[model samples]
Target: ADLPTALRLRRGAQALGGMLGPGLCGVVLAGAGLRAAMVMSLFLFGLATLAAWRVGSAQRPAETTARRGWFDEMADGLRAKWRVRLDRWWTLVGALMMMCLLPATGLLLPLRIQGLGLSAAWFGACSAAMSLGLLAGVAGLAPALIERVGRVRALAVAVQACAVAIAGIGLVRWAPGLVALFAVIGLALAVTQLVGQTHRMLAMPDDYRSRMSSAHLAIAHLAAALAPALGGALLGVATVPTGYLLLGAGFAASGLLLMAVPGLALFLRQDHEGARGWYDRHYPQAFTRS
Candidate 1:
C-alpha cells in the first residue's frame, strides 16, 4: 500500500540523517574547533528554518477550532478513542523500544567501540550500520512483514528481536559481528516503529488525529531524550554488557506484555481487515488470494 511506501520514505530519511549527522559533527569537531562545530549546527538549523518557511502553513490542521482552550484539546486527545484503545501495553512497549535501543546505539555502542581501543572512525561506522539497517528494512522488509504477520504480531516479533540483538551487542567483541547485531537491532526497531505509527494513524479519526499524533510523538521523542542520560548513568555504574543486558530485559518484558494485551485477537483482526481492504482497493487482483 501507499501507506507502507510513505512510512518507508519517512523512516529512510530519518535513518539517513541519523547516519550522517554524527559523522559530520565529528568531522567538524576534529577539523575545526568547537565554535566551528557550533557554527555548522547553526547553519543547518538555519537551512531547516528556511525549508519550514517555504513549506508555509497553507494546510494547517483544524485542531485549533475546538471550543475549549489548548489544554482541554490536549486532554481530549489524551483520552481520545484511539489513545484509550492503545492503553499501557503499547505505552510500555514504545517506551522500552525507545529507551533501550536509542541509548544503546547512540551512547553505549560508541563508548563500547572506543573502550575496545578502536578508532573514532570505527565508532561512526558501527553507529551508521544500525541506521543503514533501518533504511534497508524500511525499503524492503517492513511492508511485507506487516502484511504477513499483521501489525500487532509484527510489532511483538520486532520487540523480541530487538531484545536479543541488544543483548548480543554486549557480547560481541568483533567489529563486524557488532555491526551485524546492531543492524539487526535497527531493522527490528524500524519494522516495529513504522508499523506502530501506521497502526496509530489508521486507528485515529481525522478530526482528532493531529492532537493525538502530537501526544504519540511526544512520548517517542521524550524517551529518546531521556534514554541517553539513563544509559550513561547505567554505564557509569556497570559495564556496557551488563547495562545492555538489563535494558534487553526491559524490552523482553514489554514484548511479553504486548502478547498478553486484552482483546489482542480482535485488534489483529481489525488491523488485518483494514489491510485487506486497502489491498482490495489498491490492488484488486490481490483479493484473488483472499
Candidate 2:
C-alpha cells in the first residue's frame, strides 16, 4: 500500500499536469511564435529528463546471486506476472481500457468536430474538458469512490460508464454535448488508471514491479498506436454513431470480463475496510500502515 502511495501521488501530479499543461501551452503558443514555443517545450522536456534521471539514480540496485539469460529474464517477468493472479488479469484488462480511450478521444472526437465543421478551438475545448475530468478522477472522484467501494467494483463501473460516454460522444451533434461526453470519458479513464495501477503494484511482488510495469507500458503504447487505426477503419466502414456504439459495447464487455477475475471477486464481496481486513489476514507481515 505504501509503495503504491508513491504511484498514487505520481498519478495525482499527472492529472494536475495534464489539466494545466495544454492551456498553458496554448497561451504560450498564442503569445509567441512556434519558434519560441518550441524552445520553451525543449526546456521543459530537458527539466523533466533531468528529474527522471535523478529519481532513477536514487534507487539502489537489488542484489541477485544468479545470472540469467536475456530471454530468461524476460520470460521470468512474464511468469512472475502470471503468478500474481490480479496483476495477470489487469495486464490484459488495463491494455484494453488504454486502447479504447485513446482512439475514442484522439480520432473519434476530432472526427466528430470536423464533421460538425467546428473550429480548432472546439476540439481544444473538448480535449481540455477530458483533462479536467481526469484531474477530478485522480484528485477527487477516484479516491472517494475507491475508498467507498473497492477498486474492483469501481473499475468495473468506470469501464462501463466510459463506454457509455464514448458512445455519447458520437450520438451528440452539438459542441457542448461533445465536451460533456469527453469529460465523462476522461473521468472514467482516471478512475480506471488510479484504481487499476494500485492493483498493479499490489498484485506483483516488489521485485517484479519494474519488469512488469515495463512490459505493460510497452504493450499499452503498441495498443495505443493500433487503436487509432482501428478507429479509422471503423469510421470507414460505418457511420460515426454505429462505430461509437459498437466501440462502447466492446468497452462494456471488458467490464463484464472483470467478473471472471478471481481477485476481483473477493473485492466485489467486500467494502473497502473489509477488503483491507481480508488482505491483513492473508498478508499480515506484508501489510503497510494503511
Candidate 3:
C-alpha cells in the first residue's frame, strides 16, 4: 500500500541522514578516546537540541479550531468510536494478553545483561537480531506457516516457541548462548504479535478498527508501564535468575491458558453462523439482502 511505501521512504531518509551519521560519529569519537572529540560531540548535541527546540516553536499553529485539551479530544473519540460498543469481549481479551506478554520483553534483555553478565552492547545487538528475525518472519514466513497449519495451530506453535525461548533464558547459564536464544525469542515474539493482531483485526467489523487499534496501543503501553515496577518488585525478593525464570514460566502458562479457553474457539472461528443466529434473535439487521 501507499502507506507502507511512504513510511519506508520517510524512515529510510531519517535513518540515512540523522541516525547513521550520528552513530558513525559517536563510534569514531569513542574509538579515539580524545578529550577534544568528546567535547566536540557534546557541543554538537547541544547545538542540535537548540535547533530542535527552535524548529518546534516555529511549527506551532497560529490559531486553534477547537479549544479542547488533548484529554477532552481523547474522551470524545472514545465516546464516538464503534469498537467501544462492539467487540467488547475480544478487545478485553486482547488487552489482557498484551498486558501480560509485552512487558516481558523489557525484563528479558536487562536480565540477560545483568544476570548473564553479558555486555550492554551485546543486549543491543541481540535486540537488533531479534528485530531482523521478526522482520524476516513477517515479510512472508508467518503467512505461509499459517496457511499450512491454520491460524489457531499457528498461534499455539508461536506461543509454545516463545515459551521455549523464555525457558531457555531461565535454564541456560552460559552467557554466549543467550545471543542465539534471544534471537529465537525475538522471532517468536515478532510472529506472535503480527498474527495475533491480524486475527483481532479480522474478528471485528470494519467500523471498529480505529477504536480497536487505539485500545491495542493503550493496552501495550499499560503493559510497558508495569514492566519495571513488577521487575523491581521481583528483583527485591529473588535473585535475577529466579526473577527471569518466574517471568518466563508465567509467560508460557498465560499463553497456554488463553489458548485453552472454551469460548476462544468461537471468537476465532471463521464463520458467521453463530453471529447470524445471535443477531436474528436479539438484534436483527436493519435490512435484508434483495
**Model 1 lDDT per residue over 1-290, tens place:** 46645766888998998788878988898999799999999999999899878985547645547356777666655555333544435665667667877777778876788777778777777778888888888887877797788777787788889899888878878878888887888788788777656655655454555666676666778888889888988978999889888878877886787777665445555653363333224323211110
Question: In order, how many clashes per candidate?
Answer: 0, 0, 0
Higher-ranked by TM-score: 2 or 3 = 2
Per-candidate RMSD, Å: 6.9, 4.6, 7.8
RMSD of 1: 6.9
Q: List the residue pairs that clash in candidate 1.
A: none
Tell me how far the alpha carbon of residue 229 in candidate 3 is from the true structure, in angstroms, after superposition: 1.2
Model 1 score (lDDT): 0.72
Best-to-worst order by lDDT is: 1, 2, 3
Off by more than 4 A, model 1: 1-4, 26-36, 58-67, 81-83, 148-153, 225-229, 269-290
lDDT of each: 0.72, 0.72, 0.56
Q: How many clashes show up in model 1? A: 0
Cα-based TM-score, every candidate: 0.80, 0.84, 0.64
Put the candidates in TM-score order, highest first.
Answer: 2, 1, 3
For candidate 3, write residues 117-169 as lDDT tens digits: 66666655555555555655555576677677866777778877776776676
Regions of model 2 farther than 4 Å from truth:
56-61, 65-71, 83-85, 267-290
Worst 10 residues of 1 by lDDT: 281-290
